[model samples]
Target chain A: MPEFEPKIVAFCCRYCAYTAADLAGSMRLQYSPNIRVVEMPCSGTIEHGLILNAFEKGVDGVYIAGCNLGDCHFLKGNVRAIKRVAAVKKILDEIGLGGQRLEFFHIPASEGTKFAKVANEMTERIRQLGPSPLNKNAAGNAQKEGGQTV
Target chain B: MIVAQQKPISEIAQMISDCKKVLFLGCAGCVTVCLSGGEKETDVLASAIRIKRTLENNPLEATTFTCTRQCDPEYIAGIDNLVKDVDAIVSLACGVGVQYLAERFMDKWVVPAMDTKFAGGSVVHGLWEEKCGLCGECILHRTGGICPIIRCSKSILNGPCGGSQYGKCEINKDIDCAWQLIYDRMKALGKLDKLMEIQPLKDWSKSRDGGPRKSIREDVMIDE
Candidate 1:
C-alpha cells in the first residue's frame, strides 16, 4: 500500500495567523508545506461551513488559528471563532472523523515562531494519525461506507 | 423570531429514500437570522445531498430555493411555481412553516429539514436559550424583563430555589440560575420590592389547551 500524504487545511485569521505566516516567510522559517491556509478577515467571520467544507472535501486534518483571546481586531471575533471551532470539533466527531483531527489554536500577530512550530507539530501529529477514514485509499474501507461525499 | 436547527445530513438523506426529485426550501426570515434555513444552510444541504447521491449512486434531483418568510401566506405564494415539480418539499422553517406548506399544497409531501427549538434569542453567536414561553401572558413588567417561566429550569414563578448553588442551576452547572438572573436584574433595576407581589398560577385554560388558539381585535377588524 502506498503511504498517503495527508492534506491539512488551516483557516487563518487575516489579522493574526495569516500575517504571522507572512512574517514566518520574511524570517525564512522552514515548516511543513502540507498546510493550505485560507485567510478570513476575522476568525469570527468564518462560518462553520469553511471548516466542514475542508473535511468534506477529503482534507485529512483541519485547524482554525485565531487571534489571541481579547486581542481580536474586531472586539470578540476570536471568542466567536473559538466557539465555532469547538462546534466543528463536535461535528467532526459525529461524522466518523475522530475529534483529534480538528484543532483550534490561538495565535497572536507577534507569534510568528509559534506559527511555524504549530505547522511542524501538526504535520507530525497528522503523520502519526494517518489519513482520514474518508480518504479514497484509506485502510479502513475501500471507500466510505455510504460513499457520502461529506 | 422562530428559530430552528437543521437535521444532520445523514438523517435528512435517509428521510428521502426512493425519492429522486427533492425540493429544498429555506426561509429568509427568522430561521435565516438564526442561521438555520438561510441561503448558506440551503447551499450546505444541497451540497450534502448532491455528494451523497454521487457516492450512493442514488439518482437525486434537488431544486433549492428560499422564501421571504415561510410563515406568511404572501411569501409562501411565491413558491407556487416551484412546488409543482418536486417529489417532496423539505421545509427549513419552524413548525409553523411546515404546516403552512402542507395547508397550501396538500397534494405534495412536505418534510421538515430543521427542528423548531423554541422562542429563544442568541445569547452569544450560535448559543440560544428560550426567552418567552408565550403562555399568553405578560409578566415582564413585574420581573424587570427577565422571564422566570422559561429561564428557570423548574419554571418557578417565584424563585432562586435552594437547589441553586453559587447562582448556578442544579440541573446543569453551566446553566445560569434563572431566578438568580431575575433577582439580579430586578435588583439592579431597583425593582427588588416587586418580588413581594405574588403571581397566581398561570391560567392554562386561556392558553393553547382548549383548542387552536386565536386572537381578535374588534378595533382592527374590518366590517362591511
Candidate 2:
C-alpha cells in the first residue's frame, strides 16, 4: 500500500473467498495486487505441506479464506481447514517464523469489500514484518531453518 | 483404534535402502480408517521410497499390497502371492501388524513404517486424540463416558486436580479439563449422584502390565 510492496499468497475456497474476489473485481475495488490466490475445491483441501511449501518457496505471508465457519458448502469442511491451519501454525512457530505469518479467515461469497480488506490487511501486516527472513539478504540463514540446502 | 503417524520420509527411505525388491504392505483395519497405513499411505510410501532411491543413485523395484485386516492371520494368508518375490517388506501398519507380518512371513524381513501412537479416536478430522487407555478394564459406568485415564492431562481417575483452570488442563492450555467435562456431562444427565462413589485402585495387571495378553475360545476355533 506504500513504498514497500509485500508478497502474499491467499488460498481461497472455490465456494466463498474466490467468488468474493471475483465480486471485488466487478465492483472495481482496488486492493493490493501482491496477493496471488490459490483456489481450492474447499479451503479444507489445503494441507500442512502446502503451507510450509509456500514459505519454503519464499512467500512472505499466507492465508486461507473459506465460507464462514459452519456455512461450508460441504458441511464441516471449514472446521477442518481451521484445524489444519492451527496445526501448521504450531510448526511455523516451532520453526521461528513467529507463527503470525500463517492465518485463516471466513467470509461470505458476497462480501467483496471484506475480500479487499483482508487483502489490504495481510499485505500491510507483511510489510510491517518486513521482507521475509527468507528474503535474499538473509536467505542463507532461512535455508538452514527451512531444512533445505540453499 | 490403534493410532499411528507417518515417520519422516527421509528416515523411512533410509530403513529400506539395500533392498532391491520391496513389498509395501498396507493395513486396512485401524490404519485404513485413520488414513495412516491405509491403501493411500501404502501407495505413497512405496512411491516415495522408489523415487527417493532412484534420486539417490539406487534403483529399486517396489510392489504394493494391502490386507483386509493386518492383525489377523486369516487376512495375512491372502498376501502369500504378494510377498513371494519381494526382497523385503515395508509395513505401513501398526506395530501389531508388523509383528503379524513377521510371524506370517517368517523368512522375509518385514519393516515397520509407522510409529504407533495410542488407542484413540478423532475428535476432529485428521486429529486423533487418545480416548482409551486399553486398561483391560473400563469404569465409565460410574464417571460418565469421559475416561480420565486417557483424556485427563494427569490421567487422574478421580475428580478435578487443583491445577485445572476454567475447564482447561493446567499442563497445557490447549488441553481440555477431562474431569470437568465428566462433571458437566454427568450433571446434565442427572447423574451427579455417581461422583461421590469412590473408584477402587485400578488393577494395573489388566493392562500391558499383564504382559502380552491374548484371548482364545475353543468354541470358535476352526475345525477341519
Candidate 3:
C-alpha cells in the first residue's frame, strides 16, 4: 500500500494571488505540487456553483485566494468574494459536506512566501481528512499513484 | 408582489427520495422579484439535490425548466412534453404556480418548494416585509397609505390601541404602530379632521370570509 496524496484546486485572482504564485516560482519557493491553480480576473467572478462543481469533480479540497481587504484592483471585488465564500461555506455545510473542505484567503501580491505556506497547510489538512466521500476510488487511486511504499 | 422562501433541503430531499427522475420548475413571476424562486434559485436547488442524491448512491437525474409565468395556463401548456417525461416535479413558484402545475398535469406528482409568504416588496437587497393584507378592500385613502389591516399588530381601525406607545406596537418594539403612522401622515396632510368621522364596520363578505374568490372579466372571455 502507498500513501494518500489529496488533490486541491485553488482559484487565484490575477491581480494578487496569481502574481504571488509567479513570484514564488522566481524565488525558488518549494510548495506542494498537489495544488492546481485556476486564474481568475477577479475573485468576484468566482461563483458558488463553480466551487461546488469542483468538489463534484472529486477534488479533496478547494480554496479561493484573493486580494487583501481594501487592496482589490477593482475596488470591492475582494469584499464581495469574502461574502460569497461565506455563502458557499453555509451551502456546503447544509449538503453534509463539511465546510472545512473549502476556504478563502486574503493575500497581497508581495506575499510569495505566504502563498507557499498556504499550499503546504492546505495539503496537510486535507491529508489528515483523507479522501473526499464523493471520490469512491480516491484512496485506492492515491495509493496507486504514490507507488508501493506502505 | 408576492414573496416566498425556499424550504429546507432536507425536507425537499425527503419528498423526492423514492423518485429517480425529477423536474424542477422555476417561475419568472412574483417569486423571481422576491429572489426565492427563479432561474438562479432553480439551478442552485437542482445542483444541491444532485449532490445529495449522488452522495446517497441513488444518483437522481434532475432537469430544470423555467417558465415565463406559472400562474397562467398558456405558459404552463408550453411544458406539456417535458412534464410527461418526469416521475415527479418540484415547483419553485409561489403557491399559485404549484397548483397551476398540478391542475394542468393531472397525472404527475407535483410538490411545492417554497412557502408563499405575503404580498410585499423588497425592503433591501435580500430582505422583504409584508405590506398588504389582500382583504379585498381598498381604504388607503382614509389610512394615509399605511395599511392597518396588515401593518397593525392588532389590525385596529381608527385606533392607537392600548398597545401603541412611542410610535411602536407593544407586540414587538421592532414593529411600528400602523395607526400612529397613519395619524402622523394625516396630520402632515392637514386631514386630521377626517379621523373624527366614524368608519363603518368592515364588510367581511368581500374578504376570505366569503370563501375561495375569483375575478372574472366577461368582456375578455373567449368562447371555446
> Native contacts retained by model 2, as a fraction?
0.00
- Provide i-RMS per model in Å: 3.8, 9.1, 1.4
Error of 3 at A74 (Å): 3.4
Which pairs of residues collide in candidate 1? none
Q: What's the TM-score of every candidate structure?
A: 0.69, 0.62, 0.93
lDDT, candidate 2, B1-224, per-residue tens: 99999787667767778889999899989998788898877865675555455545686788888899889999999889989998899998899999999998999988889999999888786788888888788888877888988888778887699988999999899998999999999999999989987767899898889898887899998899
The parts of candidate 2 lying over 4 Å away from their true place are A1-150
Tell me how far the alpha carbon of residue B155 in candidate 2 is from the true structure, in angstroms, after superposition: 2.3
- Residue-level lDDT of model 2, residues A1-150, one tens digit each, is 224455688999989999999999999999887788889999989877577667755677899999997789999888999998997676565445657888998978999999999999998888788766554433343334321332
User: Distance (Å) between predicted and true CA of A120, model 2?
Assistant: 28
Tens digits of per-residue lDDT, candidate 3, B113-175, equal 999999998889889999998889878889888899999987778689999999999999999
Supply candidate 1's per-residue lDDT for A43.
83
| Stretches > 4 Å off in candidate 1 | A110-113, A124-150, B3-10, B42-63, B81-85, B120-205, B215-224
In terms of docking quality, how is candidate 3 classified? medium
Worst 10 residues of 3 chain B by lDDT: B153-162
- 2 or 3: which has the higher DockQ? 3
* Candidate with more favorable, higher lDDT: 1 or 2: 2
- Model 2: DockQ score: 0.05
